[model samples]
Target: GRALSELDSGMNRVQAMRSYAGDQLNRADRLESDMKDQALTQEGARSRAEDIDMITALSQVETQKVGLQAALQSYAQMQKLSLFNYIG
Candidate 1:
């Protein structure tokens, strides 16, 4: 009867240890999933901040080019007028 009681106690300890191990494994899985979600969120934000919209950038460049061309033409015209006139 004593030996049988000892065996029951040992089985109970083993079951408790298995339950603890399973809880630890579940916690680890939750933590890993949370980290992965955070990493993906950060990646999306970084892409939004760093990635330029090509069409918008191209339109801005074209607008600046047109403005510069207009300014150059105006300056050339002023130079032509100034070169021909003499003033004290």
Candidate 2:
């Protein structure tokens, strides 16, 4: 009985670890998606920068900064929520 109980406990831990690893993988995928979006936005801005004047370039840079800030904030919030879920 003790051996069976120990085996059960080990199996539960393994299952929990699998769940945790899956969550980590999901988080990584989300971040990769976010990075792709940002990269596209940056690429577009770069393409425009070649033809645009200084003022437009500056404006686009500011827009990019705002977008980046929002993305970071959103990522932080998601991380916090996921952590809470995992812990609680």
Candidate 3:
């Protein structure tokens, strides 16, 4: 009779341990899913930021090109004028 009672108690302990393990597994799975979602969101934002940086760099280069062209044209026009005429 004592052996039978011991077996029953052991079985109950095992069942409780199993339930606790299952709950822990479910919590870990949810955390893994949330981490994956967060990783994707960060990846997308980084891609967009890189694209914007590239666009900004291209626009700056275009602006410099226009400014350089204007300076060259102005110098060419200045060459046609005599220095003495402006000094008089």
Q: Candidate 1 vs candidate 2: which has greater TM-score?
A: 1
Tens-digit lDDT track of model 1 for 1-88? 9999999999999999999999999999999999999999999999986897989988999999999999999999888776447552
TM-score of each: 0.58, 0.57, 0.56
Error of 2 at 46 (Å): 1.0
Q: Give the TM-score of candidate 1.
A: 0.58
* Candidate 3 lDDT score relative to the true structure: 0.94
RMSD score of candidate 3 (Å): 15.1
Note the residue pairs that clash in candidate 1: none
Top TM-score hit: 1
- In model 2, pairs of residues that clash are none
Q: In model 3, which residue pairs have backbone atoms overlapping below 3 Å?
A: none
Name model 1 segments beyond 4 Å from true: 52-88
Over 4 Å off in model 3, which ranges? 53-88
lDDT of 2 at 72: 100
Error of 2 at 39 (Å): 0.4
| Residue 58, candidate 3: alpha-carbon lDDT | 88
In model 2, how many backbone clashes occur? 0
